[model samples]
Target: MSVRDFAHFIAIDWSGARGARHKAIAMAVADAAGGPPVLVRRQRGWSRAEILEVLTDGLPANSLVGLDLGIALPFADRGAYFPDWDQSPPDARALWSLVDEMCAEDDHLCAGGFVDHPQASAYFRRHGAREGARFAPEGQTGGRGRFRVTERAQEAIGCKPYSNFNLVGAAQVGKSSLTGMRVLHRLGGRVPVWPIDPLPGEGSVVVEIYTTIAAIAAGRTASRSKMRDFAELNAALANLGSPPVAGDGAIDDHASDALLTAAWLRVAAHDPAMWLPAGLTPEIARTEGWTFGVA
Candidate 1:
């Protein structure tokens, strides 16, 4: 489908915190016709379940939703999500299903158990003073530092993407990605997640996006990952012909990411090159899903 097919553009900055409401989660919406991207209010913060309901229940028809989270792991490295594990999933869908099943009983769809699992502990860096230490690998000093081919391809464009396997740092996106897998599991059959599932004949479509790529496309530098200044944020929005961000209090980095990403999507959605990058092969699409604006 084309960018004109959608009536609304929504960008979500998701959090993986194990709580009912998370202030880190931010959402922004913009009309396809062009206007300021407005932040969706959350007086008491936002819950993952609530966001899922908003998308699944009833939303504007033909909306393009951009979610800021890694949809899949670095499968191109070992050609599998979890190498040597008997329970290693073969594809992105299977990996999501396994994670959902493993953390099915956890509250708020948390994936703590998956990361803490004996078999999976070696794959991620755990929190605490002894950072970068890997478990089950027997005295390994550092956690596995790796990236998927798509991530490398994204880096080629000047955007630095964190490895989905690193979970210990402040900038780490591993936790969010793991929790997002559960969300993707529930979003199944409701909205077709781009790359993983083909674009639907009609209705909304969800695509994986890196807010940094969106920020860069909107003329922001790779070094300045966050935009707290109102002028800078609005200038980026103005570059896409979207409305400026106006609010009462201070706008945090998360909100700026969502807002700017929404604006970038408004313009980038029209470009066919983003939808079909040369690296997005049938194999990569099935194993490691491509980020929307990576190419």
Candidate 2:
């Protein structure tokens, strides 16, 4: 089916926790012609089977899905960086090398690095990594052919993971919030994932904040320069908190703060001059270019 024929898009923010405090997958859907996105469902503490079922049910044929978790690409052969979780785990160096190679080869693939290093481990502590760091044999990384996945790859697989691709400035300020918005915007308005707080009854104000930003970003209701719009919106919706709305109470400044940070990232990704709050290096700013300004 043609890209235009694809009717809906879904973004899944995954979590491994089990309880009321656990996050549910946040979902947003938009029509092919481009319109406002609607929040369809938010389920807290879903199981793998539930997630899979949601994936299968929500994603119609020809529709695209952008997931927060990694999907493993089946190797044509095996490589040096493959994680040996069953025996010896791969080191940081090996994992980095593999990521560097993969990223250099494919623009669509993201290199999050190997999961063995202290730094890498910290970065991906929540999201699980793939097993077997050993590289597949020559031509295994899909050098010339299409990447393949085994039919039995039902388990959470780790492949060339994709980053949020938000503007760099946003990434620096509120990485999670901005990245989530960027992914949602790119998917044409699909909420990236569900949000839940650490405490069982704490509630999910943060999720609402992110989803609101995603909706606004996708809807073009606010621009990169007008972050205050999001702030004001959040302030207005502070009460009536829920999966898609902030609880009723005093306005939460945190939402505005995060959205502003993300807005700066979006601005910087498009025009470096818009970057503010300082401290963002030229190198980091340059990397931000890859994620900004795609409709």
Candidate 3:
């Protein structure tokens, strides 16, 4: 579809922590007609399955859905997602299938099984001091672990991105990205994932996003991106030229994140450059997907 054709912009602040329902999962949508983005709050919190179902059929036609997670593992640096594994999948599609199949029994779409797999576990840094032998295969000491080409592009634009291979810290996205892969695999092409799946002419599509990028676009430094109260959120919204969301006092970062990103997508989606980043090769798009706002 044309960049401006998306009828609605949706942003999901996702979580990969183990649980049947996750309070950290937040969703917001900004309409093409203009207004403050609205959050899709759930009383019992959101389940990965429920979110999948929403992507399957619950969305309005021609909506642009943004999921906050790394869509694929590092490939360009090693010429393979799992450089040491003979059976490592060739591209993002196969990698998603592999993750889904391996983590089939993992409840709430968790990726515990894959991370703990004898071979797969060797590539990831899991909890409990279980640092995989190959977590830093290239012997690149200190700093962070490996990163996808898209992530490198994200870093180029003033965003501090963690390696999808590192699952240790509070900011780590490895687990969440893996869990998201499971859901993407199950979607079965019902909703197209951009870059990996070419943008369609007239339908909804999914894309990876980093909320910090949106926050930066709203005039906050990446280090000071998280807004904890209504005052801060409204100030950021003003920077984006969006109307204030009614509220006061404290607010969950998850909700504010989703809201601002939804608004950002509304504006960012109109730019053709976002869909065609200089670093995005066909090889990279198929193997390591690109983030929507990175360009």
Candidate 4:
């Protein structure tokens, strides 16, 4: 029910690159007592398999893990993740299963094929020139907004989340979301992902987190996308009652995100109201998973 219930808190800034290892991935952790969030892992090259290992191999019990990626598409607004498509999955779990099944042959556990699938391709903007395409074209990433209700709600509060439907661009999260689906599929019931699973008293709980939301909550609204400056990062941490992150050394956006989010979760996790958002009904939970700290 509160931060006291969990022993450890973590935030992972995930990457969706095609290589066997990705430098974009970063992780930070903090104690339940809520102190400064320390950068525990900064792997220049982390594979999806390696991350899976991190999740399972000797992880602390009763930990709250926050992953930065949309778990499901905006089914609440579009009526379906892929409207008129015969293979539209019934729920979040089924959707993950579908993505994993579709991209089963991809190398290094990549999910390039699912985004390029004939039936699903219409919904996602692929790589290459957009040519003013309404839907995400094959091999292209930019597209028009196709956000879910929660995403729209997040925008109202200034988070400005892009549709997972958009696979291209620095802001687009489509690739990571798809790849995360595969991770979720493999996680099975080992880690209880919040909103997808009931909030338990004790165990490792994975929840969706938006760094932007955490940033705003930490009073870093001016530094919208990334908190690169050391002063800004430390100020946000101070706002959350977290200690300063050591020296003014170079810190990339991903590292800053994981650090800030980890600190935010340390305090936000104590708010009992966070577990119950207004629109997080059974239907929404199944189709469009809720983002933690969005309510």
- Give stretches of model 4 more than 4 Å off: 1-4, 130-143, 222-225
Question: Could you arrange the candidates by lDDT from highest to lowest?
Answer: 3, 1, 4, 2
lDDT by residue (1-295, candidate 3, tens digit) is 2565889999999999999898899999999999999999899999999999999979899999999998899999999989869889999999999999999888889999999889998878877877787788486644477888888888888999999988898999999999999999999999999999999888899999999999999999889999999999999999988999999999999999999999999999989889888999999999999999887
| Candidate 3 stretches greater than 4 Å from native | 141-143
lDDT of 4 by residue, 155-234 (tens): 77887778888887887898999898899888887888888888877888899998898889888672465877788789
TM-score of 2: 0.32
Residue 2 miss distance in model 2 (angstroms): 8.7
Per-residue CA lDDT of model 2 for 186-239, tens digit only, reads 332232222111111221111112222333443323233122343454432232
Task: Determine the backbone clash count of candidate 3.
Answer: 1
TM-score of each: 0.93, 0.32, 0.98, 0.92
Better of 1 and 3 by TM-score: 3
**Which number leads on lDDT?**
3
Rank candidates, TM-score, best first: 3, 1, 4, 2
lDDT for each candidate structure: 0.82, 0.29, 0.92, 0.81
Candidate 2 stretches greater than 4 Å from native: 1-5, 18-21, 42-45, 73-78, 83-295
